[model samples]
Target chain A: MVQINFAKREINCKLVYYGPGLSGKTTNLEVVHKKAPASKKGELTSIATEGDRTLFFDYMPLELGKVGGMNTKFQLYTVPGQVYYNATRKLVLQGADGVVFVADSQPDKMDENLESFQNLEENLREQGLDPKTIPMVLQWNKRDLPNVLTPEELDAKMNKYGAPTFEAVAVTGDGVFPTLKKLAQIVLEKLNREYGLQNDGPGGGSAPAKEPPKEKEPAKAPAAATPPPKKPAAEPPPAKEPVREPAKAKAQDDRAERERAERERERERERAEREREREKDRERDREKEARPKPRDFNVTPPAQEPAKKGGGKGVLLLLLLIAVIGGAVGAGFAGKLGPLQKHYDDHLRQHLGGGTPAGQ
Target chain B: MAMKPSDTDQKLRKQRLIFYEDDIGRINKALENYQNLSKSRCNMLIDVEGHPVTQVGSTEGINLETIAALVAASFAATKEVAKILGETEFSSLTHQGKNESIQLSIVGDRTILTTIFDSQDTTVGMVMFYTKELVEKLNAIFNEIKSRKDSGKPIFNDDFKDMSGVLDDMFGDV
Candidate 1:
C-alpha cells in the first residue's frame, strides 16, 4: 500500500507489470531500467532459477518532485516470466496500486497472453481487487518480430478494457518510458484522489488542483454575508451582491449591518436550506430505508459471494508438472529414436534449419 | 486340495426316477447354516420367469406357490446385482433387518456367482464370506470346463455324473 501525507501534500504509489511467460514482461522492465533518468531510479535486482526469471525495479521522478508536496515515487515490478512460479507472481503483485500488462505480440502466443490475463484477474479476485476499477495499462511488446500481430490486431485481442496501449520494442527501449510515464501519471492521479479524500474536511470537497486555498478563502471568511437591501422589493441577485465582496472597508460595514440582516436572512435562508436539505435528507434517508429493507430486490446488489479464494499456485503447480513431464516425455522420445549420439545431429540440424536465403 | 461343487459347470442328467431323496436333509442343512439371515417371503420372489432354485431357510409357513415365486425372485435379484457389478462376478447382495428373514444367492457360469440377501438381520459378514468361497469354487468349475473344451472332448466325460443327484437334492421339495 502507498501512503500520502496531507500535511506535506505528497503521494506515493506502486505499479506492477503482469503477464504470461516469455511475453517480454521482464524485458519491459529492463528497458525501463536502462532508459529512466539515472538520478531517480534504483538498481534492478533479479532472482532467477534454472526455470524462471523475476524483475524488481523502482522509478522516482525528481523533476515531478512531490505529488501535492511529498516526493512522487513509482515502484515498478515485473512478475516472473514462467508459468510455474505463479505463487511468487501473486506475492509480487500484492498491494499493487496499479498494473501494466506487457502482452506478447506473437500471434501464436495470443491465447497464452489471454489466459495469463485471466489468471491475473483470478488472482486479483482472490486478493479482493476488482480488475475493472484498478488503474491498468497494456504494453504490447516485441514489435520487432516480423510474424508478430499488427497493432490493430493485438489491440482488438487484448485491449478490450480500453487500457492505454503502447507498441513497445523493449530490446531498444522504444515505448518503455513512455508507457511507464503514462501509467505513472494515472497512478499519480489515483493516488491523489485517494489521499485527497482526507482533505475532504468541512465545506465543499473539491480536489487540490480544482479548488486551491486562495480561491476558497472568501467562502471561508464567514464575514457575515452582508445585510440584505432595506427595500425588500429588490431582485435576489443584486440584493445579495454586497456580501460577495473581498474589500476591507466594505468587509467592516458588511460585518455590522451584515450581523443584523445576516441573522434574519440567515434564518430565512437556513430555514429554506433546512427545508430543502431536510427534504433531500429524508428522501435520501427514505431511499436508503427502502433500499436496505428490500435488499432482495434485484436493483439492490446482493451480498457478494465471499470470495472462492485460491492463489494461482494450483494452476501454476499443474503447469509446472506438465512442463517437466512434457520435457521428460520429449527427451525419452528423442533418446528412443536416436540413442545417445543424437545431440551432435540435433545441433547440426538446428544450425542448418533456418539458413537465411532471401525469398518471397 | 479341496473339492467344491459348482452347479453351472455342466447340466445334470435328468433323473427319470429317484432311487432315493435327500431333499429334507439338504433343506435341514441350509436352515441350520442360515437361520439368522433371510428375506421375507414377499421379497424373495422377485422374478416371475426364473426357476425356483430353492428356498434355503425355514420358510415352511409360506405356501408352495409363494415359495416358488420367492425363490425365483431371489435368483432374479442376484442376477440383477451381477448385472450391476459389471463383470457378472457379483458374489452377493444382502439387505438386513434385525428380527427375522431369508437371503439367497444364485451361482452362474460357475465362473461367477450372484448372491442376493434381503433380510432384517443386516449382518452380512457371513453371507459375503460364504459367497466368495462359492464363487471361487464356481471359477474352478468353469476353468475345468474351459480346459476340457480346449482338449476337445464331449462335456459328459463321466466327471459330472453325480450332478444329477446334487441338483435333485437341491430342489426336490417342489
Candidate 2:
C-alpha cells in the first residue's frame, strides 16, 4: 500500500520480501539494515526462534528521502517463509504495494521455491490483487553457493510474470542494494503512473531538463552521439522563457495561495466524506432489513417502502395503460349513445304536445 | 457506488504512519511512567510486525533488536497456541526467570509492549498492574496521533534533495 498523507507530507509504502524457508529472506533485510545508515534506517526487528528461523516476520523501516514532494518511507517486511506458516504469510501480504520474491538458487531448493511462488500467487489472488500487475522483483539468492541454478534457470521456473530479476548471495551483501534499488525504482514508477506524476527517474531527471544536461550532453558527444539531441529539442521553450522569470516568481506566490485554498477545500471534503460514510451505513442497514423477504415482509414497514419507491414508475405505466383501454371501450359504444339521444327527444316532445292539444 | 477492485486495493495500501516529535514525546513519557511504576529495568514499544516503534529505560549492553524480534515471534507462536486451545487471545504473557523476568502485552492493534525487570526487584503482578494503565495511556496517544488533522505545511519543500544521497551514504564502501 502506498499511503499519502497530504497533511503530514509523507508517503508510506510497504515492500514484502517473500520466499521459502531458509531462502535468505531474513538475511536480505538484515543486510539492508546493517548497511543502511542510522539516519536513513530504523531498528531492524526480527521475530525468529532460537534456531534463527523467522517465526513471524522481520521488519525494517527505511526512509528513502523525499520524492514527489513527499517524504517516502518504505516498510520492509519478510514473512515467515516456512510452509507451515502460510497463515502468517497471508496476514502480512494483506496490504503490500510491492514484493521481492527471494528464490533460493540451490538445486535442492527448487521444489520449495516453486511452492512458495505458488503460495504467493494464491495469497495475492485471495487479496484481490492481480499477481501480474503488482510491482515485483525477483532475487535468486545464494548465488555464490556451488551447484546453484543459473539465473536463467531460476527465472524459467519461477519468474512466470517476467518481473526484473537479480542474482544475489544476500549473506555477504552481494546484489543486495541493487535488488532494493531496482524494487524502489519500480515501485516509485508504479506510484508515479498511478498518481499521474511524471516519472522523475532515480536521478532527478526532470529538474535539470534545461541547463546542466545540455552542457553534459555535449561533453559526452564523443562517446555517444544519441544523448545531446533529445535535450536540445526540449530546451527551446524553456530557453525562451527567461524573459518571463519575473512573472514566474509571481506565479509561484499565486501557487502558494492556491495551495492554502486547496487545503481548506480538502478539509471540507473530508468532513463531507464522513457524512457520506454515515449515510452509507444507514443504507447498508436498510439493505439488511430488506434481505429476509418472507419473515420481515410484514414486520418491517421500510422494507416494503423501497419496493414501492422502486416500482413507482411501473405503477404509473400500468395506470396509463388502463386509462387508454377504458377510452377505447367508450368509443365502441358511441353509436348506442346516438339512439338514446333520439329517444330522449321524442319523450320531451310528447310532454309539451299534451299541454297544447295533440293535433296542434 | 461499489469500489473497483484496484481502488479497493489502493485504499488498503493507504495507511499513513506519521510519528512527529509530539508523538515521540508522548511515547517517551509513557515509557518513563511505566518504568517508574513497574520497577522495570528496560522497556520497549515494538510493532507487532517485529520492529521497535520506540524504547525507554536502560538498554545498555542489551541487544534490544534481537530481543524484540524474538519476543514478538514467541508471542505470535503463543497466540497460535491459544487459538488451538480455543482461546481468543491471551492478553499478556509473563516469563519467570531466576534473576530476570519479561512481560509482553498487546498494545493497540499492531504493537507489542514489552517490559523487562529483575524478578527480585519486581513481581509479575506489579508489572501487570502498571502495564494495564500504560497500555491505556499509550493507546490514547496513538489514537490522537492517528486522528491528528493539522493544516500546517511540512517543513521540507523544494529545498530538499539528495534522497538517493541518503541511500548512497547508507551503502557507501560496504
Candidate 3:
C-alpha cells in the first residue's frame, strides 16, 4: 500500500524482494544498502540463522529525500526464501506496493526458482492481490556464475507475465539499481495513474490540473530516448502564446476567470465545512472527557467485545482439537509421527518466539 | 476460497491511507498529548500493514521504520497465534525489557499505536490507562476521515518521467 501524507509532505511505498533460498534476494538489499548514499539509507536489519540464511526477513528503509517536492521513502524487504518459511513470507508480503523477484541464474536452481515463483503467485492470490496487476520486475541474479542458464531460458520458464527483466550479478552490484529503478518507476507510474491530478475531475477543482498538462507535454517529444530536461526553458513559450483571435481569446479568458472564481467559492465552502467538523470533534472530545467512564486495563475495546462475547472461543477450541487429532492420526498412518511431529513443533516454536520481537 | 469482487475492492480500499493536512494535524496533536501524558520516550502510529503514519517524541537512536515493519508483522503473526489458541485476536501486546519496554495497541481497524517508554520512568499500567482514552479519540478521527467524500485535490501531477532523475540522484554511480 502507498501512503500519501499531505501534512508531512511524504509518500511511502513498500517494495519486497522475493525468491528462492540462496538466490541473492538479500544480496540485492545488501548491495543497495552498501552503495546507497549514507544520508539516504537506513541501517539494514536482518533476522537470520547461524548459517546466515534469512529466518524471518531483511528490512531497509531508503529515503529519496525529496522528489517533486514530496519526501519519498521506500521500505525494502526480503522474505525468507526457504520453503519452510512460507508463513513468514506471506506475512512480509502483506500490503506490498511492488515486488522484485530475484531468481538465481544457475541451471540446477531452475526448479527451485520456478517453485518459488509459483509460491509467490499463490501468496498474492491469498492476499487478494492480482500478480499480473501489481508492479513487479524480475532480476536474473548470479549471472557471473560459471554454469548459469541464459536469460532467455530463465525468462521462458519463469516470466509468465512478461514483466521487465534485468540481468544482474547482485554480489558485485552489476544491475541492482537498474532493476530497483525500473520497479520504482512502474510503481510510481501506477500511483500517478490511480491518484494523479487527472482524477480531480473536469471542474478543475484544484491548481494541480493546470500544471500537469505542461509537464506532460515534453514527454511527447520525438527524442524520447533522451532524458527530458526538467527546465522551464525547455518548454516552448511561443506554443502557449495566445494564437487565437482577440474575440475568441477574450471569451475563453472570461470563462476561465469565472471557473477560477467558482473554484475559490468551492474552496471556501469546504473550508467552512472542515471548520464545523473540527469544532464538532472538539466538542465530542470534551464531552468524552467530562463523562465518567470506568476503564479496565485488561479489557479489549468495545468494538472487539462482540467477538469474545459470542461463542467464537468455543468454536476455535473445537477446531484446534480437531486439527490436533487429525494431525496425530495422519502422522500415525504415515508411521513417522514422533520425529516429524517433534521437528514440526520445534520449528513452529522457534519461529513463533524469535520472529515476533523485531525490536533491539 | 476466492474473494468476491466487492470484497476484494473493499480490501484494496482499506489498504490505502491518505492523510490530509487537517487529519494529520489532529492525529499529531492527539499523539503529542498521549506522549506527554504517558511520559513515553516515543510514540508512533503505524498502519496494520506496517506503514508508518506519524510519530512524536524523541526517536534519536531508534530505527523507527524498522520497528514499524517488525511490529506490524509481529502483531499479524500474533493474530494467527491467537487463532490457534482459540482466541479471536489480541488487541494489545507488551514487551518488557530491562531498561526500555514497548507497548503495541490496535487503534481503529487499520492502525496500531506503538509506545516505547523507559521501564523505570512509567509503569505499564499508566501507559495502558492513557492508551485506552487515546484509542477512542483516534477511532473517531479515523472514522471521520473515512467518511469524507472530497479530500481535497490530488497533489501529484501526471508526469512520472522525472522519476528516473530522482532515482539517479539518490543512487549515484551505484
- Using DockQ, give the best candidate's number: 3
For residues B1-174, write the lDDT of model 3, one tens digit per residue: 111224443466555787865686688778877775665778899987777898866676888888998999899899889889999889999999998999999987779999998764567877897788789889999988778664324435323446666876875423
All candidates in order of DockQ, best leading: 3, 2, 1
Candidate 1 residue lDDT tens string, A43-118: 5545555454553222222223433223455556677756776765665665566788988888999998998888
**Every model's DockQ, to 2 decimals?**
0.00, 0.04, 0.16
Candidate 2 local lDDT, A249-291, one digit each (tens) = 4685487458546644654575476457556655655664455
Reference-based lDDT, residue A195, model 1: 25
- How high a TM-score does candidate 1 get? 0.36
Q: Write the per-residue lDDT of candidate 3 for residues A132-182, one digit (tens) a residue.
A: 777788888888889888777887888887676778889898878777876
Compute the interface RMSD for candidate 2.
19.7
Q: Model 1: DockQ against the native?
A: 0.00
How good is the docking of model 2, by CAPRI class?
incorrect
How would the candidate models be sorted by TM-score, starting from the highest?
A: 3, 2, 1
